[model samples]
Target: DTFTEDQICQVQEIHVGKPRIVATIVPKGSPFKKMMIYG
Candidate 1:
């Protein structure tokens, strides 16, 4: 639930030219979908 909110805020910040950075946290060796990710 909170993760979704964080992504939304990160995206909005990026759109507004904010210096905040957003990074994804995944388990080591985990495989992610071959698409753009906001989380």
Candidate 2:
């Protein structure tokens, strides 16, 4: 899904001291779907 750049609220490292990412985000409109994400 394509989301407007303005829709982006925030982007940052999930862990403060770690450099590994196990999950990523897939933007969504619905609150429920929005909760789900993948890289």
Task: Enumerate clash totals for all models, in the order shown.
Answer: 0, 2
Superposition error at 29 for model 1 (Å): 0.3
- Cand. 2 TM to true fold: 0.20
When superposed on Cα atoms, how far off is each prediction in RMSD?
14.0, 16.7
> Whose TM-score is greatest here?
1
- The positional error of residue 2 in candidate 1, measured at the CA in angstroms, is 43
Candidate 1 lDDT over 7-39, as tens digits, reads 777674235565788766766656562333534
Report the C-alpha lDDT of model 2 over 1-39, residue by residue, as the tens digit.
976776655644355685777765545576656456431
Candidate 2 lDDT score at position 3: 65
Work out the TM-score per prediction. 0.32, 0.20
Consecutive 10-residue window with the lowest summed lDDT within model 2: 30-39
Candidate 2 backbone collisions, by pair: 24-38, 24-39
CA lDDT of every candidate: 0.57, 0.58
